[model samples]
Target chain A: MTMRSNRIGLLTALLLASTGMPAYAGEQAVIIDNFAFQPAQLTVDAGTTVVWTNRDDIPHTVASGDSTLRSPPLDTGDVFRFAFTQKGTYRYFCTLHPHMQGTVIVR
Target chain B: MLDVSEGRRDALKCMLWGGAGVLWTVAGGVPKSRVLAPAMADETGDGNFSFVQISDSHIGFAKSPNMDTPGTLRAAMDQVRRVRDSARLLIHTGDVSHLSHDAQFDTAAQIIGEAGLETHYVPGEHDVLVDDGKNFFARFASGAPHGGWYSFDHRGVHFIALNNVQNLKAGGLGNLGAEQLEWLERDLRGRSASTPIVVLAHVPLWTVSQEWGWGTADASLALTYLRRFGSVTVLNGHIHQVMQKVEGSVAFHTARSTAFPQPAPGAAASPGPIKDVPAGKLRSLLGVTAVRRVQASTRLAIIDTPLGG
Candidate 1:
């Protein structure tokens, strides 16, 4: 039942991430697939929150290139959300597969 | 435009789902695979000079293909034990655990320790998930000092354990880092060119698949130091499948995972465990033997035996 229960929980989370039912004004999303970050660069407001969803079957981590942000290992359909509190450009990459990189330009 | 097939992309993918350790022989710059070990075992005369190379154990993995990782690893150890009587030792290429948990490491050590051979290990990206591989090095490479990268001589063979899973730059593949490279240069500065060298790292030194990040970024610089050696064998893991290539005096080989199997390079949409393999056919699909002959009086053989088969 652990696998089944976990799957159900994950499915619910995926629905929430994809549907964006409660999406606020300053929230964005980034998807990970094929060992690359979709939306290589994303521009969001200073107070906006960015949620990274891993669609790839493998696990990946959203880590700051300069060690500012670090996300736990996100499995398939898992999500990691971070809020950009300041106005600056932030670069992040997957710690597991560092080649998958993305940037967030906060205005 | 004409519709094409996926089979023609890379010819090597034909031998895709190889598992376990393998036997390798380098004769006149060409690598060959053999089964019988006694032919060259007589040349070395150092008791049993053959060692086993195991990779990608992935202990915490409990999905698809096979759910019981420990069971399969036990069977692999049994297979190693079958040849252990005539084996020099065992070398693990890495991916010892699926998630780098202390319990995962404990389970991996408890099972792999049953082999009773002084096993040499390198850290796969998976193993370093916890405390930058502190748990893994604490178990196998405690003497490595800092980076879990070290080298030693065994039976005239200079064996190097390199950590390519760390210092990985964004948009880059596995990296040896400038520090490890400098260490390697100094480590080989006073060595003889005639010596036989075996390199163990978690990631493949050669670029097996660029899109998948299956290769190392700074491997070329490290290869320059090794190119001078008369005979060099590089063993790696993290790809979860067997792939081999030979260049000049160097032969690079990747072994199978005792836990699960991954798709061939570009054979699927992405790289991960091949979850759809038929239930019982899992082990055999992951078992492929590689054999090699060394003309430098090394006479070393590696057997990749998946005991379940």
Candidate 2:
């Protein structure tokens, strides 16, 4: 009986670890590295806050092609966060290095 | 080494050639550029004092064409040491580091400090990427304004360093904002019109290439204030190449990078480092610029010398 309860507790801890702490609601992270966005495509629900963290040594920017969304130059370890309000596809590229591209889909 | 010939109405034609050295002479408010052998640039100007301008070090960058950025910077510094006696003051335009990391800034600072010369700096877009230039301002622009713009006077020449990288727009044109512009107008109000004004910024004050975001927005207003001066020399370093233009009394020149060279405007699909540069040609593409005060004259002559030469 005690062993079963301990196992259940372990399972609960694993589930919590996988789903993350409850304090943060609908937060997603995207990494900018190697002159390109890691996981170039991201999907999240509406009202979710998406944070872009630059890991590359060089500077980059997150700018939408249509001039809707734009970010200042991001150095290494710099973060730019935006909360999606409506559902749509957001495509972006680094204005400094335009070859680096990424996409975000809000559903 | 200048061959000055009369053009239309007192206009001088500047003939510059790759691998062929050129000397620029400005006298009596007229500009003349002469193309000679490559080594002639080192000893062309007749000036009592000279200063060097190095830009775009990009210290922490780890990429192709030039992964060892610090090594390249050290080489550039070696070139500085060679011209140490002539070029006393050093001015770095921007991009001290590839990333705004503390370590990157620290490394670049140590390397630049080895030059042992009085150095002036203005923050680049890369330097302000993290924390909005808090790290850069604290290190280089201490006691400066909130946005890190400042001015100083040296050897009868007034130097104004402006920060235009703040509050960048979607089009990538740098913004100087209203506050700085007002400050600049007031700063120049009391100065004499005969004073040789040297204005330094990270991005070109003039429009080099709007599509590449090489120009500063609202720079015309700044130029308006400088137009009164007899010799208004504008120096900048974001494009990582040598480009010059003269608009009336204002002469705009951009310096090359000490790290890597970027493709010319519209030369490539994107404006980044030239990755496919030939193995031995990298150092030749990167170098330093020197400005000298003409002897017994008020004109300031500019000499751009590459590292490889």
Candidate 3:
């Protein structure tokens, strides 16, 4: 599901439970689709692993703007996982479709 | 022209029945392309010398539709050998490997070497998956610009090899960037517009299907540099299919893959190895062959034949 869809699901779940839900910890995912990343920007804790899954049918790659990180061509269903160990905002885009940008703010 | 249309119609009919590839002959600045069965291979090329174009050899690709990509690539090389004597040069449009691993490049080199023909290469997006094509340039000719785009002259034809795959822009479109565009302007400066200019790159310089990111974003700027040319042929191989388009003096062609075939533009949910073509017919759509004729003309005659008969 897309990030919006997941958010809606979470909201529904929280409403149904009537209890304050705990925040997600340590792991996050970015979905690649329609030449854009779902949840174009993300925030996570330091030492969290961000997994980018290609939901689109075409191939895409995750690459850092400063040329520090890159992933091989990720065909449909392929997943690229990276661990952000430091507290900084990591910006990246699909090398194949540069317009598709995303960010992960590690706090 | 009517006869050629009929020929294409017949070729399309043949394609439905599993016959693939076209034979082209150019003379007096006019190009004639025809589709011939492998049985009619003898009719394919009649030229002083012809060159081979093979594209999208995704060596590390291990997916459905095709599992043994190297085997299929080897078969493609065999087809190249079949016409090696008549074809003097082999130009691989791009995507020499699925990933730009050293071993993948080595395997591609070994298989392509079997053809025993001099080969020229450009980078495909897959081939540049690592270090922005550093490993790819290291294996091939080094003199190209930092991004591996260059041009050369051969047999009275000025072949301009471009690197559109690098530095992709928004919308997943390929980019030639300013540096390459400047070089292209200077490269074409003062050259006779009448010269037959062949531009080679990985993605289609012309917009084929924008939704799939098959086109180059800055291709129009680069093409503007060649507007004065009498005949311009742009060849590319990212979409993994044989598609042709003609715009005034420029002719654009994209080649099929030796690894696997992707859906036609907007034909599938998204583009990847088409998971399920009829088992045997898959080979019919994926292969390479060449056709040419010698003449002092500025037009390009392209012939694409599948690796299998």
Best by TM-score: 1
Off by over 4 Å in 2: A1-58, A63-107, B1-47, B279-309
Docking quality tier of candidate 3? Answer: acceptable
Q: Write the per-residue lDDT of candidate 3 for residues A30-82, one digit (tens) a residue.
A: 89886678889998866678899988755788888676668878878999988
**Candidate closest to the true structure, highest lDDT:** 1
lDDT of 1 at B186: 93
Model 1 per-residue lDDT tens digits across residues A1-107: 99999998888878866975332337798999877788989988667899999887677898987788888888778899998888798998888887678899986
Residue-level lDDT of model 3, residues B1-309, one tens digit each, is 357765544333323322222333344443343333334444435564456677887787765555566766775665566665666777888888877889989999998898788888998888887776898998875777676878898766788999887777544688889999999999999998777888899889977778777788888998888877877777788876776666667777777677766777667655655655663564454333334322333344433324221
- Assess every candidate by TM-score: 0.78, 0.69, 0.75
Native contact fraction per model: 0.59, 0.08, 0.41
Best first by TM-score, ranked? 1, 3, 2
Give the Å error, residue B92, model 1.
Answer: 0.7
lDDT for model 3 comes to 0.71
